[model samples]
Each structure stands twice: as structure tokens, then as C-alpha cells.
Target chain A: GAGVSQSPSNKVTEKGKDVELRCDPISGHTALYWYRQSLGQGLEFLIYFQGNSAPDKSGLPSDRFSAERTGGSVSTLTIQRTQQEDSAVYLCASSLFPRGPNEQFFGPGTRLTVL
Target chain B: QQPVQSPQAVILREGEDAVINCSSSKALYSVHWYRQKHGEAPVFLMILLKGGEQMRHEKISASFNEKKQQSSLYLTASQLSYSGTYFCGTEGFSGAGSYQLTFGKGTKLSVIP
Candidate 1:
């Protein structure tokens, strides 16, 4: 089976620009999550989408960060007015369910660099 | 809050054993373990629920101590392939029936042959 995948494995952009990172979760997985990993740091939860319920945007660092899962399978994370602080690896994960004991499958991630 | 991982980094011989620990300040619903090699995606190792269950995958095992709000990952006879950063993700109940994982800083394990 195909694992979770992200597009544009690498992205380098100027500050104040907007960048959109895409994620394709595993088929049939109802739970999707977006995370960010800064250099030598742990994974930081950004947002979550479970089935048709409202997405959890609590982890979004600022108003400029947003995400939407379309048709419950693909998710796009958009960072408006990117800054140097936004340079990090963006990871996407999916699980079979939302609230139970389930393992999340991760994608290769998109390395975004804001200059 | 995010969990805290101990021994930020460790080095072991191929035949040695190692243990990584994760602790949280808040009550935990589950603890998830993952290993990530450099420049690659993180791979799930195991998950332990709130019941304080222990799980094993190959020579890798984990124990969740619900009462203590902590978890430990045990790797026996460490192989070179085990050289990677191990992370513990903690999940707890938020408001509105929401749940998400908060990962620790991670433990970097280097298994030398």
C-alpha cells in the first residue's frame, strides 16, 4: 500500500511569500495531522483534521498559518507571509481513527526554507 | 504540554542495550513511539494505551506507566539499524473531545558496530 506522501520535497522561498505544502494521507485513514520540525527540535503539532469534524487549529502558531483537508483525503498547509522562522520540515501523518490507540503513518515531509 | 525525553542522546555498541524515557506533566491517554533516520520520515515503533500495557516489536519494547504519566522504550541487543532519533508522542484529552499528540524533544541513539 502507498504510504503518506508530500509534494515538493524541498521548497525555498523569500520572506513575506506564501507557500503551500501538500499531503496525501493513506487511503481510508480518517485522521490527518500536520506537524513542523525545526532544526534539532521535536515535532510540533500544527493542526489536525478528523473525518468531517471541525479541524483543530489550536496548534497553528499564528493567524498566517492555515490548513484544509479536501474531501477528507488530501490536505494543504498554507503559510502566508512566510518568515525566516518558518523554515522547517513540515510533516504530515494519518491514522485510521481519531481518538483511539492507532499508529500514525508519516510522509517524507516537505523541507521549506524561507530566506 | 509536551512531554520531556531523557538522555537527549545515547551511544551504544551493536550488542548493547539502551533505554529511553519520556515523562509528562499532565495525565496521558496514550504514548506513541517512533524512530526517524536522518533525512527520512518517522516510522512508528509502538503505542501503549492508558491501561499501562506493555508492547514489544522485535527486540524493541515499550512500557507505559499511566500512574506516573511516563513511558519507557527498551531496545535490546541494539543493532546498527537502530541508530536514529527516537521520539515519544503523548496524547491527552483536550476540550471538545479533541486529541492530538505532543512529542518530546527526542533521543538520538547511535548504535556502533
Candidate 2:
């Protein structure tokens, strides 16, 4: 893909149901990021991955959230046992490693609805 | 850590100027600016590195002061297309491959012509 792509642009599920979001970064991007934006809120950082570097999971709000980037290319964010408060737009972004300084290219994002 | 954003929201007429501020509690390595319109993803504006230097991207510009851990985005002669939420992503530390982006609450800007 020419840019970062996400699957299932929108998802609706009942509380307690699990959801998996996928992200395919740009072909050569080595750093991927996952963020969540609630209604009328700013982008919340969830996790980040960089080639050869241990993934940073500090930004994740809770243990129910987990993510993994395979071969520094593709990544997935899994939210377990969703709750009504979990509804938000999940955004994925990629960049060529923020070496000295660089910008992140973001995807359109997936809107998750928890009933 | 979350930075505090001021002027929660702003409404401006085309060609007017606006300022959005992001203040962090922790020391900042750099501050990044991004614009996100309704229903769309964020678009990078520019990043202000340490040393109080300013970074400019087109008509949008930003400045960061490592000492105060604060950043501000300046929009001069705004256009209707400039209406959107502006965010500041701050990096606390920088060294051997340490990069993490912490965004502020955001300021919603509505430009009315």
C-alpha cells in the first residue's frame, strides 16, 4: 500500500466481545503506532513498535489492550472483553523510524462501537 | 503523561490569527504539531526541536521551549481549510533510540469565512 491501511473501518459489537484491529504500514516504514481517539477527545497513544527495539507498551490504558508488530511491517491491536466505554476510533500510523526527527503518516482509522 | 491545552476551542475568520498552546509537566525533547479535520486522520504540521528554535510548515509554524516543556502552534492568515483539531505531541526524552509521542488534549479550531 502507498500509505498505512487499516481493516474493518468500522466495527460494532456487544460488551464483553473481543475485537481485533489490523494495520499494514507503508512498505518500508519501520515504526508503527496505535492510538485511540474517543468522542471529542485528542489522540491517545496506546503502543509503539520500532525495528530491533523492544516495543513500548507504557501508553496502553490497561492490560486488556495488546499489540504486536511482525517483522517490523504489519501489526495488530487486540482489545479483549470490550466495554461500552471502549468505543472509540482506533488509529494506526507509521514512520521511517524517528531517527533524529520525522513525522508520522497516519491511517484513516477504525471506528469501534461497543454496545 | 498528558499535556494541558488551552483555549479548549477557537473560532476564527479567514485571514485571522490563532494560537494554541500545549504545556507538559515533564521535560520535553521536542514538540510536534498536527491537524485533524472532522472524520479524517491527523496531518503533520511541523516539529520544534530543543533550543527554542521554531519549525515551519507552509503557513503553519510551531515553537518549543525545552526549559518550560511547553509548545505553541501559530496559525497566521488562516484559511477555511485550517478548521480542525490541532494537537501537540511531545517527546519526553531523546537518546539512543528513545522515541514516544504523548499528545495533548487538543484544541478545536473552527475557521469561518
Candidate 3:
């Protein structure tokens, strides 16, 4: 089976520009999540989508960050007016369900660099 | 809140045992463990629920202490393949129905033959 996949493994953008990162979750996965890994830092939760319920955006650092999952499979994270601080690896993951001991399968991630 | 991982890094020799710990300031419902090699996605190791249930995966095992809000990953007879960064994700109640995980700064483990 294909694991979670991310597009444009690397991206470079200028400050104040907008960038979008895409993720394709595993088949039949009902839950999807987004996270960011900064240099020498841990993964920070960004957003979550479970089935058709409202997505959780609590982890989004600022208003410039947002995400949407369509058809319960593909998710896109958009950062408006990118800042140098946004330079990090954006990761996507998926699982069978919303809660429980389910392990989230991660993607290779997109390394974004803002100059 | 993000959990705290002890010993940011560790080095071990084959056949030796090692322990990695994750502690949270707030009560936790479950803890998830993962291992990732350079330039690869994180691979799931195991998950320990709040009931004090201990789970094992091959040579790896984990224990969750609900009272202390801590989890420990135990690796027996470490192998060179075990070299990677280990991350612990924690889930807690936030008054909302949804559950999201907060990950800790990973612990890098290097095992040599």
C-alpha cells in the first residue's frame, strides 16, 4: 500500500510570499494531521481533520496559516505572507481513526525555505 | 502542552540496553512512540494507553505511568538498526471532543557494533 505522500519535496520562497504544501493520505484513512519540524526542534501540530467533522486549527501558529482537506483524502496547507520563521519541514500524517492508540503514518515532508 | 524528553541524545553498543523517557506536565491519556532515520518518515514503534498497560514490539517495549504522567521506552539488546531519533507524542483532554498530539523534541540514539 502506498504511504502518505507529499508533493514538491522542497520549496524556496521569498519573504511575504505565499506557499502551499500538499499531502495525500493513505487510502481509507479517516483522520489526517499536519505538523511542522523546525531545526533542532520537535514536531509541532498544525491542523487536524477527522472524517467530516470541523477541522482543528488550534496548533496553527498564526492567522497566516490554514489548511483544508477535500474528499477526506488530500490536504493542503497554505501559509500566506511567508516569513523566515516559517522555514521548516512541513509533515503530514494519517491514521484509521480520530482517537485511540492508532499510530499516524507520516509522509516524507516538504522542506520549505523562506529567504 | 508538549512533553519533555530526557537525554537529548544517547550512544550505545550492540547487546546493550537503553531507556528513553518522556514526561508531561499535564495528565495524559495516551503516549505514542516513533523512530525516524535521516531523510525518512517516522516509523511507529508502539503506543501505551493510560491503563498502565505495557506494550512491546520485537526488542522494544514501552510502559506508561498515568499517575506520574510519564512514559518510558525500553530497548533490549540494542541493534545498529535502532539508531535513529525517537519521538514521543502525547494526547490529553482539552475540553474539546477532538484529540491532537503534542510531540516532544526527539531523542537521538546511536548504536554501534
State the C-alpha lDDT per candidate: 0.92, 0.85, 0.90
lDDT of 1 at A1: 97
Residue-level lDDT tens digits of model 1 in A1-115:
9999999899999999999999999999999989999977899989888874545788899999989888889999999999999999999999998755689999999999999
Considering only N, C-alpha and C atoms within 3 Å, which residue pairs clash in candidate 3?
none
TM-score of each: 0.97, 0.93, 0.96
Q: Can you write out model 3's per-residue Cα lDDT over B7-48, one digit (the tens) per residue?
A: 799999999999999999988889999998988888998888
Q: Which structure is stronger by lDDT: 1 or 2?
A: 1
Give the C-alpha miss distance for residue B39 in model 2, angstroms: 0.4
Between prediction 2 and prediction 3, the one with superior DockQ is: 3
lDDT of 2 at B110: 99
TM-score of model number 2: 0.93
What DockQ results for candidate 1? 0.76
Q: Could you give candidate 2's per-residue lDDT for residues A29-66 as a string of tens digits?
A: 88888899997678898877886354577778889988
Per-residue accuracy of model 2 over B11-77 as CA lDDT, tens digit each: 9999999999999998877788889999898998888888757888878888787777888888999
lDDT of prediction 1: 0.92
Candidate 3 wrongly placed segments (more than 4 Å): none
Candidate 1 A-chain TM? 0.96
DockQ of each: 0.76, 0.59, 0.76
